[model samples]
Target: MKNTYFLKAVFTLILCGFFSMTYAGTIYLSATGNDSNNGLSMGTAVKSFSVAQGLAADGDTIMVSGLIDFVNDPGNTATTTTSGPSTTNKVGIVITKNLNIQGTSSDTDGFQGVDTQTFINTRFIQLTADFTLGLKNLKLINGALITDLTTVAAGGGAILMTNGAIVAENVVFDSNTTSGHSAISGGAIYIGGSNGSGKATSFKNCVFNANEGTKGGPIYIQSVGNGGKITFEGCAITNNLANGTTGGSAFYIRFNAPTGKPEINIINCTIRGNKVTANNANGGAINWSAKTPNTAYVNIVNSTITENTTGGSSTAGAGIYFAFGTNATGNYGNLTVSNCIVEGNKTDAGVASDMQVKADAATGTAPENTVGYIAVKNSMIGAVTSLAANVPTANITDATYYNYITTLTPDLKAMLVRNNPDDLKVRYYTLGDGSPAITFGKSTFLSPITTDQLGKTRPSTTDISAGSVEKNPVLGLRKNLDSAILVYRNANNQITVENSTNDYTGSITVYNTLGQVVAKTAATGARTTIEKSLNAGVYIVRLNTTAGSAAKKVIIN
Candidate 1:
């Protein structure tokens, strides 16, 4: 009897442990809900995000309904005076475990996507654990006024990740400020650590606007030993301000290791309209500094960096500032600009505007003082003056280079004009007819880039264009082919092709908007009819012959 009782107790304890390990549940929060509720369902949802944070464990999901006011949370207020390296006091929505926090449509399972207008306004949020935290379908607008800080240790006005990873999708960080501090930085988001534990933080389809930081207006990333990796994909960073003694109006990255280099990749992004107010500011859009022997790799691909300005008399690199400290080696920490548009970036009078690369004087027994390399290939760069000679190698093949001036040819000047001045998110200029940028890109570079900055496909046969906008196949054809080939849609919704001189016989193929060949027909005489019925939409008609191939656009009624 005694042995059976002891066995029953052991079995109960084992079952409890198993349930604790396996029971990953979803927690819900709502504005009308009470903290006394269980938070297990929509009806039992809690009221405060902090209350949900206290109950959530790793691998759990927190669905927040309505706007969460972090400022008025009783639990957050009670702990506002706490102090520590990973302190959650005063910081809003402190995430200590791997969890997914998303906004919901209702209190139930129906989840609404992120609302860009509504946001959680708070001091800041910190992720201290070495796990992946996901924030989706929500905006984080931090209005915290930080002061009396003397180091970069305490930063991140909007979101801070000390050693964790963050996957933020469709989020907006707007108007966050880190001011009145002696050494404040990272106005919007800060990722600081050397542990190299967390996965790379990725921001996809996010917007960062009007954030102000002493150093990095939108973001500041620092790696002391082993650096961190951050990627910005399809993100728009605009209208941010950097008022630090030194400046990175959009972001700042520092790598302080001797060997392992941190990496920052910007792909399909628009970084424009940011400003650096301090005199002698660097990188109105980005400032990257490599300390000691450490290295950092920055790749800007299929993006636009334009209209960023610095305020000082001797400011340099209003677009980007890449600095290499003593003891750095090779292209390990180089900046590569591929298939990008960098234009209209300006500095104060007598200052370098487009970009600057600097290397500290050599020390110890190093063979050479190699700061870093800046390679701009298959890109359109305007008004670039580098401080370090032989550092920037501009591969000008099929690339356009022009200073901001009104005296340019009418066609070229039209390509530099902004498409929409009212929208800060619109980064690319429209390529006009007879513009040099049309179909002038090299095929080698275009092979890797499937689509242009505006999500437009490059012309299939012809060369790609410089800058973010890829010319349409019809536009390229209009410039390449003679005006004798008349292409139009007939009354029967058929494509009619007529060569006036009857000098050519070729095959015709029709392509849809997705670059897929939809129809094919043979052209025997001067005039040929495509018998295939077509939908009422735009299509590209390609004519292939012994002479060459040309494409034209036709719309069916």
Candidate 2:
């Protein structure tokens, strides 16, 4: 029995050693190949990223040196290379595992993978299985092509992360292309599961810039079947253009309905300078949605969204458009935007009355607002125009109107709008000093407050809009006026008015709009209630005391 035990232990040691050796395979690729099978050593470097990928296993590493060219055959132009030729192919490298693909320099940026024009017109990186594709300290860019038609079709040029987990650290996605005008496309990085909740993906510390496509010019996440979850952290997505009217510029996450799943979380990211242009395009920095049971959970914390535009025949969010994945009735999903800055997003060409918040139904109609909800707490949100210009005053609680619009023409609205029903409310505090968005909110977000585009703490106590907060206590009533009103609302929407020089023991009189004394009461100790029938309109309520009187407008809706 002792001999048997010893043999077993020895066998286990041998197996561990073998497994470690297999996992330790690190193949290097460069402009020159050593033409040796010993890929574990740098001296025996492989010729291309494809050869390295073929030699790698699940957790292997691929170290790239010098300018390595990858060919992509999106159109299946070559009978020789299923992937692509080393010269003018469609895709350069296809990732199949949780491998670390890295470059030598930290300052330089270029495409870790490249996809060019092709006859078959396929995706740049078509991910068929589940894996983790990591691009470390590299750049991927520019997806454009001129096809048979007179017009040019562009996109689907960067990393494609489908049915798996994708991560890019300090990488850039820039110019590349697949089809011309007729391109079935995505650019930068496209993530999603199979049809029906089968894929999961995420990206961190990445940059997506100057990438163009028909839909999802920079990044697209389409999760079918229960949908999938996509998370972005410490990344910058900017200057990406999505062509056509309906495409989204920077990020477009859409899922199917009913059994659809949602798991979209964006944290500590910067999304700016992206455009969804002309015709039905959504120019927002990020457009995310979940369908039916699949709730698109978008949590943008400690991030900044600015200088993004969305417009054309119809327009929506310049910063973000959060909704239910399903384009069906009453299927609006859920959204939670906390600790972020969404400012400076606008419609095309100086359009007026662009809103910052818009909520509508899926079918591009109206009156099915129950499909989704938005909850924006402890954050800063304001617009170029006054809040009144965004929605009709009567629709504050007009559930029928919101529902009908969201269900009918969800995207046929004006510029820079946010859609958050009563279920999805926005709350935040004020900023200090010279800031535009000081004291400009109905509520205050409370979590790790979002910083500005330059990484400054968004003030939460005294400001109404972004880049503005009132910190000096010396300023009297106007100090954070919007926040003060919100605070009053927090106190059950009841306010007491009094002259600063008055005492509390005087009798107070209340009157109606017809100059009739509706009720009278004594100011007992410090407060008194006005007893009168109040309707849904604004009413001027006056309180009389020994030092004179004070009148204020109270909205009782």
Candidate 3:
């Protein structure tokens, strides 16, 4: 009898443990007319998005029903109402735990009361605490807001993230705004790390449209109290707008360095139609303040930043702005552009500051003390047309500014030009044929199939300029081109070639900017090595492969 009782107790304990491990919290809310306290039944759901949020714990799930708006008056019968999404309702639902907030699939299951009009008045979500908020299969709209500056202060708008780790998946942040009052600005989403974690928040498979802020229209990541980490993966930020001086309409990463600093990583994302008006600083879609962090600063990898416009011809950095800082000297951070596309970012009348010159490049120039530092690998950076001839204005209205950047003045383009001018040193394989962002960046991994804002691959071959060199030259001009080419030349005018191709079976031809072939060489597979000297200039490489023909560009040191 004693043994049987002991066995029964053991069985009961095992069963309880199994149940606890499998159990997950569930909370149901309704934006529709129904209000039920029976949290278990769909028809009997809670009323407010906040109530459901307050009740959720770690590993819990919040389910919302009906169409509701935090800004607009729920009593309004018409969709177009004057008093829409207002501060009276903060965020629809804010989660601080590693929980999931999902919506029903039917039209009646989600919040449908949100619209552009309402988004102008309130914020949809503000995530600050440390936790992963997984939002899936839900349509979240009209979030974050910009109060009318004509009557109120320019500050106080959008979703502000002071410190925390967030995961926003398959979420939509649309029509959000923070109208600028001169310098005060707002945005759809604002993330900062004042706690110095350096890992702030991340957005995955998210969509941002028509969000507006004076600084960063769609999204802004700046150092707060402490530095944190911010990352964007497989996301889209388009149709974002800044008033005039702010950059990174789609997204911007700035290091404040108040105490600790933050790092930024943007991967597999698309940024397009983001605008920075004239009279603004670093109108390029993305601006790097280069403020020294207690630790490392900003890093962007495997992303696409294209088709962004600065308002006026006098503006600078339609693609990127690397602002100089004095408070933090050697603390200059690093900007690594790898396996990405950066095309169609243009500036006004004068050439936009492509890259800030550093020590070696800024020897005798003003601001002799270089502050900005950037590294480019296996990437391409050029104007849509040859910048060697005509300079475009900084405004988006100009046709020239509409083109991408090419023929950058290295002395003016960047602080550091890594790898080769014509080759992107980051990728293992080269891009091929008619791609706009050919060699725009170097990548540590293989390229993706998806195109950028301009619908071009991250690293396309056939660049107007020698952009990048990839690992595999299967289709492009590597077959007929020399695997090794000269990069830099010495004062003696001696040029050397370094063959770095996996397979070198193509002919080599050199050319000047005039499209005239200056030198030519023929080679067979029998001997895979060749040495030659040539003048410093741009050249083309055409290869005839057993499969077909292709072309690439080469630069003589």
Candidate 4:
């Protein structure tokens, strides 16, 4: 029994993604160094990342400094043109082992910080083995995908992951692109486009801001086998452009395997302001489709998707759009939304806005159940287009569980630094004053996805603010004067209340700005006086009248 219990415990830890990870010796690379010296120490560092990687073993660290320009590395240059990707594809240096490509920096806010990032420019990285890589505190900018191959398999403008997983933190993918005629998919990163299956890759506190591609503006993920997974926690997917005439401006996900379940998990992230400029496209922020015999699963929690646009697409799902199967059988794709704020997105002039789940009967055999389904719970939705009967919505429209912004008092439209080009690295949307997103999330949540996107502790373990920035829940209530009921403070600092109408008979309550009740009394049509000493401040006085519940500001001097 003890041995069995130990095995079960180990299995639980494994399922929870806990494992021992250790790195070997570090190989130092500097801009002003020579390859003839041993690269084990910083004093004797090598000049190139390629030479450092060649000297390091598996599970080692390649500490880089300054600009590690791949254009100068003779092993791989930006001008090489090759094809097939049978471990011989060129245009960049290919990493063949598992190594932590550590950049000497602590800042990854995209622009300026204390740790000057070791910028990687000019070439993309290809993985030929199933190795796990750890990337930390760096910026990959101005990388280009070679135009040797003309198929979608030749994807990934910045990186092409044929196999293995990469856990990246505090990284930024900026200004990566593909030659439009190349017909590639991913602009920032591509995973499992060829016969090689994708592994579980995760990015935490990362930014995918400026990338353009034909299919996916910033990223494209596919599963050729059962074990592919993509997880984005505390990430920002913003301002990307999907130039593809097809769709998927920010993220495009495709499941094309015959078996295996592919999954995408997005938590505490923000998908905003992306655009798809295609004549006919689907999602402005995200697009997903699964082929026959495969079921794709997606779970979105405590995130925000808003302000995304799709041009010329008459009826595009501006925020999120997806379909599954081709009239074949099986629930090819499923999505679950929990405690998320998805609203205020714009499509075309005549189309819908926020979210849409369309039906695709492209190509399939005798029907089995090739339909897609969505489960929306505790989410604020502005409009949903083409919602089918298969979608199960729970508390989507209920104000008690989910709140929408209809008035200016609690407006979500007022954002901070959203259009400021100078501060684009640290830009995030604010939930305006009196927002319902304040303190709206539960404190207890899953472990890894609890933090906010800006690499800070969420005010609630839980963004407390819902979207990105954590705001204090000092919501100012919209006060409406109730003529029949009057409440004020006496000269002696005692609270006095009266019901002018006989019909009004209920309890009266006073609360502070933090949604905490400070005082309460029972009303019975008689002049009531509460002897509780109150301080000088604004308080919301609520009355439970027979007509309905009402609240107004009762100034206490």
Candidate 5:
């Protein structure tokens, strides 16, 4: 019996060692190298990224030493490449197996991942097969896409991902774009292809700037085949343009079928200065259309969406658009806007310019399919609304539909000296001295507050700021802010808000379950109370102060 066990263990070790020996190792690629070389070491590097990809096996590492330039390749013809999407045969590499593309340097500048020196220009990287792709410390610029006249399958100007998982860190996609054709989408990256098992797609510390596309300037996710989670953390999407009328200049996510659960998270990021230049475009930065049988979830937490612009005069959501397509009635979707600063945007959607909720589009989907569920809390925005079942846009009768569109006009640029390092094209909004966003974030709205984008330690729950940029306290309102401003029902059935903090002074409102304000009054001095006779019910008490705004639940007997 002891001899049998020892032989079994020895066999297992031999098998493990054999598998480890069969695993592919590293392959080096350089601009000045030759394809005839072995590509096994730095001295014997290959010239073409495509050649290196063909030579390597699954799980092989491609250590890129020199900038890979596709346009200046030695001898290649018949294939075409452009700065954006086209109907040409794109000259690029097709990734067929699992691999890692690592660059020489991985310098990070907050949301900006690239410096002025390192760059790699490629036409495209088509991932048609199911393979996990890992990219680190690399910049893909001027990547384009190709599509035939009929099929709309060719999207993703730079990285066309359809199957498997993609984990890219410290990567920058700049000036990548697709054509203005009505069928094409995704300027930088496109994720859509029937249940291809794309469950592990996440981008960390990435930057997407100056890209152009038809639907989504930088990204368009049609579907992921099965259950998938797409996340963008500590990233910046800026200065891109969406040429098509279907908006989402920064990102457009559309659900065509309920193939699987699709979730997208935008945490600790900045989406700014994007544009939708089409005549009837909406959602200057993001357009979300759970327009089919989709159970999707979108969480925009601890982010900043500002200065996004839409072209149409009657457009909605300069920062974001909650959309519904034809035949999208019975579908359900959820949006949570927490600890965000979505102000200073350009939109013509009434008083809510920063963000808009419009179930008003009539074409495309059935009228029964255009409604959704949304919650906007503890954020500074231009406007927000609620979502009811089977309704496009309904009255705010419940807590799910909420809005706090203030005219604070927070000083967003160069307000105070931030700890952000200099980048090649990095842009971040720093809250000025006494900016309203500085201690206006609601900690309980989402998760516990920890650090900001630049890795600044935040205060406790009561004193956190709203946007991704956490500011140092000039007044230090990050402690006991709730105790400084109190809102309660008086003995005479009146709503009273006592503000011991001088930074808070604006208005107070009392909303009942039926979405009607039973009482409202201007806030002034130290103690301000609204005299209103009320009955027994639970209500939502909201306070809009100069520094920021907050809401609470109150019960009156």
Candidate 6:
């Protein structure tokens, strides 16, 4: 009886110990911390990241100091080569368990309440095992090329995720490169999976700049098996270079799975100024290739792909390239682009300066069985040199509008202007008046997106504009202003105000550009005719309602 009781007590104690280890306490890291400390609190923080890595377990949180050199290991040296890992290198932060590594800032200017200075100047993070990893509020820069020698998975100057889920938010990856030529890819990040396995990765509010690789200068995601999903939201990938024969200067995605197709969702991203500098390079901004019988899906919503170029006889897709394998049986890949602006992209070989979609074979069993398919809706393309049969004409304004009409140039410039070509952050192309892009979008899209790229609500659910910024009503009026009242001038130089909603009790006022009140009328309901015999010129008409007020520019002929 005593033996049984003792055994039960021992088992219970083991379970308790397991739970305690699994729920390990948080570890604090600082530049001035001592490596011999316990690292459980801010006072007893650890100095070296390597020591923290050894002490941390699954579900542990590593709170790094906001100091610039918190994780910038001086002992870690980066290699200049492209194909292999560093020689005199620190093994990096090899994460085998689920962890939350965060950079804490004391700066009041930061958005997250704390001004955490999370910058890593050297070394990279590698996720070798399958688990959930969260990295937030950090900047990774000047990381050397690191690769898995066995799998030939090179690149990832900042991070390499072989098989795991990663959520990276508010991070910046800059000035990282893989210089040599042995299948070097993913200058900033490399996500790889094989044998019917894949990973789910998401990047939110991240910036990748000046990273170089043979393919995917900023990011490379490849899946040899089934089910690889990647989402990049509000990311800026710019000024990256791809020097290999096959392109994707900013991003490369390969869905090589034979059974299930992988998916890539890019929302509100700006991919610009990336270049491909080799022969036969494709997709100066993005290169998507499907090598299996299954179909890979890529959805781009409310984004901008512009100013990317390809050189040295690269024949297609300066902004984007979609290709399918020859041996694929079913539909290989699919691309859905909505509410986007694709402009200023050029290719040296002169195929399509903006985008190119190709198949290994022209003939297929059915329409859905083609090598690849592209669907573009509510978009502005700089040029459409090919794939006219696949591209729809609904709510699509081509470069010809800008090329033919001189008066429309100002409006186009106002709507699609890149304020600064050099910097990616200040890039904004909002809608201006008299632009065909305004109120020309389709009522619905394949994706459930209700907001524009800038997080503004669409004025009309039925008729939204194209590109990232939706056109708001004049003078910050309510969206139902148009529905409430209608104003127009008749043949007798008299202004007619028609209120569709009987509940609208307001006053009508007209003024000229010089702030002089030309006419005024008090509404009594329904139709209110005001005889304002004024000279023929431009005037501003305003309606004041109990709910709100609306203004419109009218020309009296």
Let me know the TM-score candidate 2 reaches against the reference structure: 0.61
As for candidate 4, its clashing pairs are none
On the 0 to 100 scale, the lDDT of residue 221 in model 6 is: 76
Candidate 5, 287-320: lDDT as tens digits: 8877555666778888888768888643457787
Name the runs in model 6 displaced over 4 angstroms: 1-24, 67-91, 105-123, 146-151, 194-199, 312-314, 325-331, 348-352, 360-371, 387-414, 419-428, 446-449, 458-460, 473-557
- Cα misplacement distance, residue 229 of candidate 2 (Å): 1.8
lDDT of each: 0.66, 0.50, 0.50, 0.65, 0.68, 0.66
**Candidate 3 residue runs with Cα over 4 Å from true position:** 1-18, 41-43, 64-68, 72-98, 103-120, 147-158, 180-186, 195-200, 224-227, 258-261, 293-295, 327-332, 348-371, 383-557
Q: Rank the candidates by lDDT, best first.
A: 5, 1, 6, 4, 3, 2
lDDT of 3 by residue, 463-488 (tens): 21122222223223322233343233
Best by TM-score: 4
How does residue 452 of candidate 2 score in lDDT?
Answer: 36
Off by over 4 Å in 4: 1-23, 77-90, 106-121, 193-199, 327-331, 348-352, 360-371, 388-423, 439-448, 455-465, 473-557
* TM-score list, all predictions: 0.71, 0.61, 0.63, 0.74, 0.71, 0.72
Model 5, TM vs. native: 0.71
TM-score of 1: 0.71
Over 1-557, each residue of candidate 2 has an lDDT whose tens digit, in order, gives 99999999999999999987765567776546553555666677765566677777777777876645444322223212323332233442455666777877534533333333442322335454666666687755443332333322223565554455665666666654433443335666555455333545556666666777666877666553355566666666767787755556777666554454456777656666777776455436676645445444555654556567777522466666654423443334555565455655667753421223344532222332333555554343434232332333332321211211222332321122222223112111233222322222222432343443234454455332322122221111122222222111114444344333334356644444444555566665434554444445444444444543334345565
Best by lDDT: 5
Q: How accurate locally is residue 392 in candidate 3, as Cα lDDT from 0 to 100? A: 17
Clashes of each: 1, 115, 72, 0, 11, 5
Q: How many clashes would you count in candidate 5? A: 11
**Whole-model alpha-carbon lDDT for candidate 3:** 0.50
Model 2: how far is 77 from its true place, Å? Answer: 6.7
Per-residue accuracy of model 1 over 1-557 as CA lDDT, tens digit each: 99999999999999999998998778998767899998999899998777887878878989877766665666543113214332322455566678888874212322221223543234546676677888777766655535553543656777766777888877777777776563567888877765456367888777788889888898887663355677887678889999975788987876555456567788767788898898756566888775545546777776668778888543367887776644343222556677676766776552436666665532222222233645666665665555434342242333334333222421222254566868665645666543444554554654654676566776665466655566654444533344667789988899988876577777988887667788898876789999988999888787776666567778776
Question: Which model is ahead, 4 or 5, in terms of lDDT?
Answer: 5
